[model samples]
Target: MSMDPVETFRIEAAELLEQVEQGLLDLTHRLTDKDLVDAVFRGLHTLKGSGAMFGFDDLAAFTHHCETAFDRVRKGEVPATVELVSAVLSARDHMRSLVEDEVTQTHRDAGAGLLADLRRAVESAQGKSSAPAPVDPAPVAATQDAPAPAAQAGWKLWFSLPANAMTNGSNPLALLAELGELGEMHVEADTSSVPPLDGLKPADLYVAWTVTLRTDQPRSAIDDVFIFVMDDMQLRIESLSAETEPRAPAEEIVAEAPSIAASADAPAAPSSIAPRAAAEPVAGSGDAKHGKSSESVRVPAERLDELMDRVGELVIAQSRLSQLASASTDLQLRSVSEEIERLSGELRDTMMVLRMVPVATLFGRFRRLVHDLARETGKAIELVTEGESTEVDKTVIERLADPLVHLVRNSIDHGLELPADREAAGKPRTGQIRLSARQAGGEVIINITDDGRGIDRERVRAKAVASGLLEADQQVGDHELLQFIFHPGFSTAQKVTNLSGRGVGMDVVKRTIESLRGTIDLTSTPGKGSEISLRIPLTVAIIDGLLVRVGDGRYVIPLAAVEECLELSLEDDLRSRGRSFISLRDKLVPFLRLRELFRTGTKPDPHQKIVVISTGSERVGLVVDQIIGDHQTVIKSMSKLHAAVNTFSGATILGDGTVALILDVGHLVAAGQQQEAQLRAAG
Candidate 1:
């Protein structure tokens, strides 16, 4: 389905806004960087022009002020300052609201206030720098062998819009009017491309234009006039000197009329002329690359999701066909099933790749968050990101964003100390928060670490004890004690503040991670730092699972978590019956008996299997009646009635149509670890 043009503009505007914010944030570090200044200006310019083309007059008008401010910075009329960047950053947020929602009184008032601040920032910057604004240089002489000079005093431009321009709601006359705003101009339309009445397409654009302008603005300003249409339109710009006549054939030189000369103060009124000779190519002109096609297409996320669902359904049907083929006597049926299985597998992999997106998209937003946090807390802080190129399921990225935000905010608010305190502790005045991610097996490990005062064990214990979560003088490991921070309404803060100390965020983070079938591990050192690692699966839609039979019921274990399978002989099983521990390579590993856990009265098979699974450093063994080979499992969410069941993450249908439960590896590992601790305490 074709997307609404207005919706498409919204997406493009969002990306432009992000670019503007990133550039402004970068300027906060290097205020004198000219390249950054130019980038900021270009982003703002393109956004304003595109907004106008899309009929967002309010946005276009509001953004024009910001574009002009940056233009001054680009021209050395004003210097880049933290104050200026902050004002623009705040305004960039308002631009997002303008794009997303309709304008209201509140929005108008907010925009006015932001523009007022922007004006003050520009004025303040002007006062700080007493240097005179740089003067525009004289137009450079053009050479036959050299590129067109950008510092031209006058320009002659010829351009034609794309055939679909009219259909896509573009206005060539409005573009001409904007060019007239640059300076004194003369425009002549060439109707040579227009076909006969029967051959003409009303919705298509066929008219080409020739425009000559005398202005102090550089060639870049002309390019900005067509920024939105540059990728698909034919455009040629040639520099001209004031004294030189236009390089045109005698037949092309029609009578020059005074009324056709568009003044900077007036709207453009272009005239139509007779057919002229084909435009001559200028040296170093990018005319050859006009109407270039893009290599990639933008696809909506919902469409991708719908396609994934179809692929998943196909996989299930293929599995059923394979099952029937295995029991069939006909060789052709079996062969067809095998081919379908292979093709379905390939399609599933391809669909999975389409749904994967880089973690960089998730990490980029935090730079702005950290910048704001530093100002809010009055503390010097730096954020370092690593492994941003790691790719994960798009759904996982979306769900993980809020949890990461809560974690980062808590790190800044609770983990880091003020500059004076840090200096007194013989540490750097500026605290650092490092966020990194890497893939391990089928899981992505995202770690958020902060270099500052670590979690205070004493305070955590006090809070836990006071909240009745622990007894007085109860002994607990550092890892276990730190987890108390994630308990509901638990806090070590002396008083509540805006960022943290309310104790509402961490528990939600824990719940959200658990809902995604992921686990969180917290580690800290005294007076050093703290690190929180969240291990989440690469995708939740489907997985390769080991189909195993426990008693009369069958279950699926995630293949990523399976280490190795060992035979549980009747001798070893009876000897270790009560202990529920298995000996592996001379080391003891805790094991869970599914029959007993599910309270199934059916006896185990004579030959049983112990499937070894591990999550991070913890490992556990599951004793099952039979190992039923591997299956491609499509994960289906559990109903609210089974939400309390921690042993199984979800359920899936088998080839024969029976439902099988998918094991929750993280939950089982924690259970095994708890059992190990209990056994040790009892001994």
Candidate 2:
């Protein structure tokens, strides 16, 4: 991968934007939650700096405005109002759109709308509520719920450059240009710490600034200006109110409220809260007022994939060396082979870590989803997420978002009963959805569950039969009937609504899960809610694989799916000739011959091998001609021509430069179950 610094910044900026959006959404739940406020402020602040670093002048300028508003709230000059939160939330989306517009060479509204909204939100929180309210009634509650912030003294700003700030090429002048937006400013450069010009180090920053700003805007506006330089202490601030009244459209009413400008007993309140306004820049911060932080390092996704590709090659080279050493009597070759194998194994372990990402990133999106869904459905839904720190391959986590969204939406639309209906049924009015994830046995399990109206088996059966998906005389179990929901054109809604029931989304979820080589389980209990679960391999692009030969062609089975491998004995082979079944631990497990399935013409060997593979609850044995041992498979997606080739997930290159298809264990197990069904019918 090219080490393009610009691309690196782009990815980081996007992540920060998401964090800001989440913080904005969370504000509604915990209006006084200092952490969310700081989090949102920190995200916006970092975004502004990073945007400027990448020459995104407009982005940097716009985000600076938001950072300021959050800053005031943090310093206690203002409180978190629903109106303020909603305004910032909308502005956050606009900022993302702006970033994309810049990248795509499209029209840039120059962040004008977002900037205006941000200013309005800040102003309203400062006791001026008339800032550009939407014509629609959606935001009406938010406006009424927000209490204007208490007035403070004029804005006070302090900045301490990171000791080596100048060496890093950060310009203090830029911080100054934006701070000018907050009315009159008196900047006092702290040169007392500076050494004489002769004794001075050119790259060392010996100067800091303390600026006094006189402005009608809230103190947050000033804090926003210094968002980028915050950590370096290049900026610290305390705001106070001037004796004269600042005129606002809501000034006449805001004047009616007694203002809390300054308290002689608490001078540090404004300043301490000022720094704390930005979100958790600190790592592992339990104290809400003071956040945890560490220096951040950014890496490119392409670089990670490039590293994985190299590791794959190293694995193949080591495999060839291992084979050569096994066949040759040369001592030197054998020694080199052992050394290479050890090094490659260690490198692969390191590469896995590099490719891993915390699941918290994925979980963050649900906060907003739940919030919007609650607003739309007029249902009180509290989403509880667990195991947020679970880690998975970045690619796996990315593809799982859409399916999870649909599942949660389905739970809200049908699984969750209306509030009044729930209450009438002797249940709590508020519905709860639990999203949990954990790594188990080389795969990750994600569960979406709701405590609402459970799936109605009768309704499902009726829909299946009406849609010609089930026989009128069929007696499918409740769990089996639930699976029918994922069928194309299968829906059980009595009346179609905006959320669901057009017979769409579920099939797409099925298609996507299968594409990722993941399995979905539908479990339901009448009046006890339903749980839709997905079991996904940790990484789709790379897997630890067991390479084997069935005929002349080889296949790779995911190492995670291999339960056990056994050699076929004459007694066991003859006992199950017509039907393929292996007695493992006194339990009969069905087996499939891959050679016969592929229609490969080959004579049966004297002895064969059976590899036990499974997905979720089903178990199947794959009979092959030979055991080829373990290989690190670099998964390559099949071309569009092979997209419908459900039997195989993808193809990987072998050590001999030949391609071997990676078998999809879930698909094969299902096929085996179908075969068992056919045999039962014939019997």
Candidate 3:
């Protein structure tokens, strides 16, 4: 999709933020880096201009104050200092909040404090610099015929208003007047479009004008003059090859075009641009120069979701066609089906790209988190991030934020050691926390590792046993004991401060990850700190499924979880209802009977099949009447109406218009665990 002006601003704003943050950090190290100072000033200048144009007035106003202060520094009048950089850093965050306002996200407490600090800096700097020169007004010239466009000295613009210009409330006079604000300019009115009195529509535009403006602004500045009427009025603004105007304060110039908009920052012209009967043309200030135009259109996020839903439907329809083709003997129909399948696959890939976003958006948050934690805990800590460009589904990114925050906080509060204690142990005073992301197989792996004193296995084991999460007499490996920390209400910290230790956050992290159908692995060494890695699927929207016919109903087992399919004789199937076990590769694996579990009453086919699936370490085979081959399944959430039903994650439709339920592997795994627990208790 082509980016509109708003999107353009967003892209530019994002880069500006990166520059501002990096500049702030570098300034923290070298306060006198002139390049960094200029870089920051440029970023602020662009942000202020773009924000104001896009209707972010509050942001523009706040940033304008900041930009003015930075501009002073760029001019070498203000010295770079820690307090100055720190103030700007804080202002950068406030600017972010303002930009989010463009997207209408919630962030409050606008930059009042930042503004005060900026003004203080500006006033202080001014005290150390030469007095600023005053701005000169436009000098009415009598060289209208003596000048030769100043020999490429400035811009000469020629623009015409539509026929009904004056009657339509566009005071062409004011537009010309605003033109003069840039510099000395001469205007000639054309009334050719204005018909005779008998043929005129009083309200219709019927006038045009040609003006030579001498200003430093690019052609874009001239376009701003008629921006409000650009699309409707056949307005064409071009550079004048040459201009010879009498530089005189002529009353005739205003008399000829006594009906248009007022000049920006200049005296009101005889002709009002607003065409409001020679009255005030400006309701607000003319400082905006020209009206802002956006390159991108603002589309609500919900509309994109709707588009994705339609695309999902199209994919499912294509899946059905593919199914029908593989079964049919007609060559032509089969060929068409194959083509449709290929096209649909390509389309789906494109849609996937639209939904994918880099994990860097998530990683950017930790800078602030780590910075705050360092200040709070008074520990020397550094945060390092890697693989920021690794892409993940948007939903996954949203869900990953909370858990990541908790992990980083825990590392700062409990995992890292105090600087003095570290020096005593001959370790560097600064603790390092590394957050990295990488794509491994079908999952994205995010690891948050700290180089502080690692998790004390002994303390964890003691906490697990004492908290009743583990039995005292139970003989458990350190790995198993460490896992218990993910159990709710289980923490090993000796005491509870604001940081973590009170045994609460980790369990939520575990639960949230599991809810996303993800896994977390924890590893740590006594003196090497801890690393918690999260492995989550790239997307949860669609998957290949092994469809099976159970009795008369159809079911789909996720192909990711299914190992292989098996055929069974009637005798073997009938005899295994009470206890189903399959011999695969010389190993016996337990299985579930779909007929009995789904409570299907009809008789199974004489020849049946078993679909073997596994979740984590447990493997289970499902007995069905027949295998329905592989099908592309679009996951449709079991509506809030059916959300409580645990056996199935969602439902899908087949080629012949049959509905099949997609099994929830996580649920099945839990069910298997429950059965095992019961059996062991009985024994």
Q: Which of the numbered candidates is closest to the native, going by highest TM-score?
A: 1
Taking every candidate in turn, the Cα RMSD to the unseen true structure, in Å, is 6.0, 9.4, 10.6
Off by over 4 Å in 3: 1-19, 22-34, 52-58, 72-83, 96-112, 115-300, 325-330, 494-496, 501-504, 549-553, 561-627, 670-683
The TM-score obtained by model 1 is: 0.89
Q: Tens-digit lDDT track for model 2 on 197-298?
A: 898877665665667776656544555555554444423344343224333322111111111121112234323433222212211111211222223445
TM-score of 3: 0.66
**Considering every candidate listed, which one attains the maximal lDDT?**
1
Over 372-448, each residue of candidate 3 has an lDDT whose tens digit, in order, gives 67777889888899999999888789888999999999988878999998898778999999999999655688999
Ranking by TM-score, best first? 1, 2, 3
TM-score of each: 0.89, 0.76, 0.66
The alpha-carbon lDDT assigned to residue 295 of candidate 3 equals: 39
lDDT of each: 0.83, 0.73, 0.69
Off by over 4 Å in 2: 1-13, 38-79, 102-160, 163-170, 174-228, 234-296, 566-588, 639-641, 656-659
